[model samples]
Target chain A: MRATTIHGPFDMRVEDVPDPVVQEATDAVVRVLRACICGSDLWAYRGESARQPGQRIGHEFLGVVEETGSDVSGFRPGDLVVAPFVWSDGSCEYCREGLHTSCPRGGFWGSVGSDGGQGEAVRVPFADGTLVRLPADAVSDDRLLTALLALSDVMGTGHHAALGAGVAPGTTVAVVGDGAVGLCGVLAARRLGAERIIALGRHRARTDIARAFGATDVVAERGEAAEAAVRELTGGQGAHAVIEAVGTEQSMRTAVAITRDGGAIGYVGVPHGSGTGLDLSTMFDRNIALHGGVAPVRAYIPELLTDVLDGTIDPSPVFDLTVGLDSVPYGYEAMDGRTALKVLVKP
Target chain B: MRATTIHGPFDMRVEDVPDPVVQEATDAVVRVLRACICGSDLWAYRGESARQPGQRIGHEFLGVVEETGSDVSGFRPGDLVVAPFVWSDGSCEYCREGLHTSCPRGGFWGSVGSDGGQGEAVRVPFADGTLVRLPADAVSDDRLLTALLALSDVMGTGHHAALGAGVAPGTTVAVVGDGAVGLCGVLAARRLGAERIIALGRHRARTDIARAFGATDVVAERGEAAEAAVRELTGGQGAHAVIEAVGTEQSMRTAVAITRDGGAIGYVGVPHGSGTGLDLSTMFDRNIALHGGVAPVRAYIPELLTDVLDGTIDPSPVFDLTVGLDSVPYGYEAMDGRTALKVLVKP
Candidate 1:
């Protein structure tokens, strides 16, 4: 089998790698049907992350189960599934409390303890707790190709931001970026009953997608202009909720500044640590509630999968470009160069 | 009338100033029965604040209504009242939303547009909003003093912390800081139905007060030890709610650390600008919610006043020392030297 290996900054190549088989009783082996590059993957591509050399990189995917260990009961061969970026045991104390991101016994792929999904076949630990089975029989190519693949990572992440920010019915929400995750935030806010969804996007194509995802308004401004535009749309009262999908200082500040005095702000972007200078006083004075962390993607995947199945949300549209496992390097480059919003790779 | 004036950082003076009278249609003149030094006042006293020179310097007091403008109807001459430190007009959108501290036309005493309360007589603006009328008949002793004087600010602030933190019955609560506000937090937590109250206090006297105010456990450690102590008391789950009463980095971190995942951390102290560097990743990862500010003190005074009148909670023990209005400078020195947790000056 061939795997996408990270050699150095902006240097990736597909190399022949040993195939994976289930090692744990609760594990399963999946044949990758689709996998893709995430925005966070660019962090490593740019040498901005602590990822070591030669590691397989992808975490978002739709795969078909090829084999399962004896202890794996709920899933079997030939079933299509979506697994969250992080694997969890689903029974730990943290998992019980829905903090699956901090699951004690669970290990994240591509970072520590296990090989990631950026290859032809990958071992999935905690299969029962982590994998969401797709609806039987009607897994259409278009449905499988939907932006729902992003739900395995980015879309789930955007939902985390929306939930953490307390987006609810009648709330006005401002999303800070137009990336896939941010576009998903616009969708998540719509699903969560947001009345007014504003997407701050500079990209025309992505902004149009955001509108389709339920953004009632779109602002092409950044930083102060973006904040001012949001405030103006909100009648100078500021948004009731803000989802900060960009990890830059300007995005974070816009998230805070565009929120009302007692509103909520949630950030899910993997921050670059560039904007370390947060005005703690201003946030403090506003009495706003701040809550977010890396998304417990596994915890949200089931609901998102259901939405994908019912055709309530078409997350598959984000896969505007597709390539083969041999072209994973090109996929990364295209996304890094903004030539593609997302790239789906067929193994 | 005599007043406590902020000359500069580390410089304060007791001087004769012109007696105040109703200056606005919504203002009232109060003959201060007692004025006190507050922990927040120390910010200006130490010259760390941007307060200008020669300004009246206090925000907590019990006083008698001396006169009122033609439009001030709810308050009249001879009424004993507890004044909200943050004066509001009770009509602004923010005020209507129960955010009197952020009211556009409102003012916080001795900090920005309003005069301080540390004097014989202070002008209490927005009388209908700032002054909470006390019961007509009162026994003029320690209990009445505790209920009236302390409830004027610190007690209300403590309630704000518990409320902002969303404390409810049977919730485990951790309070950081040993000042009057922290002690009041303990009391407020009890009033809000907390089943377990762990107070982190370094001072024996303050800890004793915390215990008296219904803290179930007291930890004498400042930083890590205090957090450990609270975690131990909580059976390693950490507190469901955390009330932060100290503005230093250590206190903020300790407060953030001891709060359980998916918990609320509310802070009420005047923040120092050293930048404690909030772990946004940690905040996001834990799903912890942070809500705080200067305390919408004005918004809460009415309910607290009713509690004080009904003998539900006594907060007067915080007034550990008292002196005449002429001794305002000494009161500041006493609080600065740690000789008095709070100082009340009578007109």
Candidate 2:
């Protein structure tokens, strides 16, 4: 089988790797049908996030089950399914509380000694607990497939940001970031019934998508100007809900600054810098609520999936470019170069 | 008139000051009937928090309105009233959102050039916004008057903590700090129907009050031991809601550590140390929500006043010592020396 592998910074390649097989009673073998590159993957590509030489490297995918172990009762061969970025035991206390990312027994895909999702096949542990089955007849629809594939990460993550920030009917939301996750956050806030959605991004193409995703206003400024623009748009009160999808110190600061007193910030961006740059004193003085982390996408996938299937939201717009297994390296380069909002790979 | 004033660190004095009179159309002159020393005041007493020499000091008090300006519509002469720590215009956007502490026009009591609560009289700005009227009959009951005084700060502050942490029926709550606010937090959680309340404090006397206020368990441990005990109490899942009433870095850390995944920590303690010491990375990975700040006690006073008047709660137990106006300096010493949990002052 061929899989995406990294040998160093800015180096990606598709090479022959041993095929995955069900190794435990709770495991299942999934033959990849569709997978995509995540913004987080760019960290490893740029050597910003630590990665071993020649390690498997993706965490979002959807595929058909090719084989199942004895204890996998919920899925069988030929079933179409989606896998969340992390795998966890279904019955754990944290999982029951809908915080799958905190499950002690859970592990991430593409970690050392594990199979990556950007491959021909993946050995999924806790199959019954991790995979959500999809309707088989819809595989012929490419648009629906892309939207469904988004449920593996971005869409659900955006939902996490919205839920964390307490987005609700008649609330005003400001999303800071122009990436696929931020665009999806705009969509999620809209789905949650936020009356006013403000997208703070400088990119025209991305902001266009944001507008389509229910952003009622767009602020193309950065830093203090961006915060000022957002505040101005919201009548100097800032947004009731601020979604911080860019995990930089400045972005976090902007998120806090533009949040109204008694409002909340739902941050889903993977922190990349040295410090969070969170001014607790300022946040304290403003009565701002800060909530979010590695999003528990699995907990949100079911609802988002229902919305996707019903055509209530079309997250497929995020996948502006597509590639095949052989061009997986190009996909990484495209995402890292900002040439693609998100690259869809049909394996 | 006489008022409590700070001469220097560890030096408090009750000195002669000009009697207050209604100065603004929105102002009212309150004759101090009851005033109390707060834990936060000790910050200035210990010189940890900056204060100008000879500055007036107290923030919590209840009094009788001696006079009202022409524009003061909500209060009049002879009316019994309780003043929240801060004065606000009441109609600002932040105040309307129940975030009076963030009101743009608001100012703290005893701040430089302002009249302190621990005085014979105070010219309260925005009388309609800062003071909640009490029944005329409240003066006859010492215990009820003490509880009403608590409403001006601790009780309402504790209620803010519980509300911020999202405490609800069937939720398990943990309170850090054995101070008046933390004890009131235990009572607030009980009022909100929390199924199990864990009180963390080392003081025997305070812990007894915690039990009486509905603490189901008491953990006298600090730091790691405290976290371990809380986890054990909740089957290693931590508490659903954590109230952090101590402003030190360790107290915030403990609140975060003992919070269950997907749970929240409501911190009302004024951050005393140089840095918050919050590990955002850890909080992010664990999905812990942090919400709180200087409590909007003014917004909560009306609700709490009802409970105080009806005998539903008695926060007066926090007042372990009593002193008269001339003895205000000694009251500060008692609270600073830890001999008093809180001190009630009569002028």
Candidate 3:
């Protein structure tokens, strides 16, 4: 089977690898249909994150179950499914609390002994807990397929940001960033009935999609100007919720500055550059609530999948470019060069 | 008029000061009956925070309205009242949203032009917004006077911690300090119907008071051991809510560790050592919600005052020692040396 592997910084290759097999009683072997390159993956490609040569990569994919262990009672071969980025035993306390990312028995894809999602066939642990089955006819629809693929990570993550920020009917939300997650945050805020959604982005193509994702306004500004633009839009009080999808110090600071007193800042960006140090005095003075971490994608996938299936949302457009499995490197390049908002790889 | 002044670190003195006068149309002059030495005030006394010579010191007080400006309609002469630690205009958007501490026109007591609450008579800005009038009988009841004093800062701050952590019936709460505020947190959590309240303290007197305040258990451990004890108490899952009342990095880290995945850590400690920096990766991985700042005492005073008036709560016990204005320096010394859990001063 052909799988994506990283040899070093800016080095990605499709190479022959052994097909995955269900080795554990709770495992299932999934044949990949679609996989997407994540923005987080770029960290390693850009030498920001340490990666061992020949390490398997990618954690977002949708596929058909090719085989299942005896203990996997809820799923069987030939069923189409979407697996969350992290696999967990659904019965753990954390999982029961809908925080699967913190599940005691869960692990991320591509971690030691697990198969990466960007491969022809991958073994999934805790199959019954990790995979959500989709209707048979749904797999035949290309649009729904792409949207369902997003539910595996990006869409679920964006939804987590909105939920963490306490976005609700009639609340105003400001989404910071023009990346796929940020655009999805705009969509999530709209779906949650936010009265106003402001997208802070500098890029024309991304901002256009942000508008399509239900951003009520777009501010192509950075730093203090971006914060001022949001405050201006919100009657000088700032938004009730601010979604921080870019995890840089400046972006985090901006998120805090533009959130209304007593409002929340939901940050889902993997922190880069410096350690996440907040201005405690400011946060304390304003009583701003900071909530968000890795999205519990497994907890949110089912609901987002419903939205995708019903055509209530079409997050598929975030995948601005598509390529074959052999061209996975090109997908990475397109995303890295800013030519593609997100890249979809069909296996 | 007499007031408490800080000449320098460890240099508190009771000295003659000019009588307060109502200068603004919205101002009032209040004759302070009771003022308390707060744990935070010790920061300046201990040289942890900078203090200018002859600076007025206190911010927590209960008193009788001595005089009011023409526009101060909500308060009248001789009416007993409690003033929040911070004064606000009550009309700003932040104030309207119940975040009076962040009101644009508000300022902390004893800051520059503002009169300190520790004086015999002090001018209060935004009288209509800052002073909550109690029944005249409250002035005669020493117990009620003390409890009402707590409403100015400590008790309200503890309540804010519980509220920020989302404490409710059936939730387990761990309070990470044994100070007046932390003990008040135990009381607040119980008042909110928390199923189990764990008070983390080693002092016999404070722990006894914690039990009296409804702490179901006491964990006499610090740092990792404290977190371990909390986890063990909650069946290795940690508490649903943790109140971080001590602002040290270790205390904050313990609060985060003892909070269950997806739980909240409400911290009210005035951050002292390096800026409040959290392990964002850990917080993110666990989906921990960090919420808290200065308690919006004005927002909570009304409801908490009802609890005091009805005899449903008696927070006066937190003021274990009482002294007169002449002994204000002794009050600071007692608290500084941990000889008293809290000090009450009568002007």
Model 1 residue B273 CA deviation (Å) reads 3.7
Pick the TM-score winner.
3
Ranking by TM-score: 3, 2, 1
Q: Compared with the true structure, what per-residue lDDT tens digits does model 2 show for residues B102-210?
A: 8989999999988999999998999998899999999999988998999989999999999988899999999998999999999999999999999998899999999
What docking class should model 3 receive? Answer: medium
| Model 3 regions more than 4 Å off | A274-277, B274-277
What CAPRI class is candidate 2? medium
Q: Find the 10 residues in a row with the least total lDDT in model 1 chain B.
A: B273-282
Write down the RMSD of all candidates, one decimal each.
2.1, 1.7, 1.5
Estimate, for each residue in A1-347, the C-alpha lDDT of model 3 and write its tens digit.
99999889999999998888879999999999999999988988898888788888999998999999999999999999999999999998778978899888899887766778888988999999999998988778888889889998999999999999999999999998789999999999999999999999989989889989999899988888988888999889888899989888888888988998889999899888323436777888788889999999999987888888888888988998999989999889988999999999898
Candidate 3 residue pairs that clash: none
Candidate 1: regions farther than 4 A off: A274-277, B139-141, B234-237
DockQ of each: 0.56, 0.62, 0.75
lDDT of each: 0.82, 0.91, 0.89
Higher-lDDT candidate of 1 and 3: 3
- Evaluate residue A22 in candidate 3 and report its C-alpha lDDT on the 0 to 100 scale: 79
Candidate 3: tens digits of C-alpha lDDT, residues B153-174: 9999999999988899999999
Candidate 1: clashing residue pairs, number: 12
- Chain B: TM-scores of all predictions: 0.95, 0.98, 0.98
| CA shift of A325, model 1, Å | 1.5
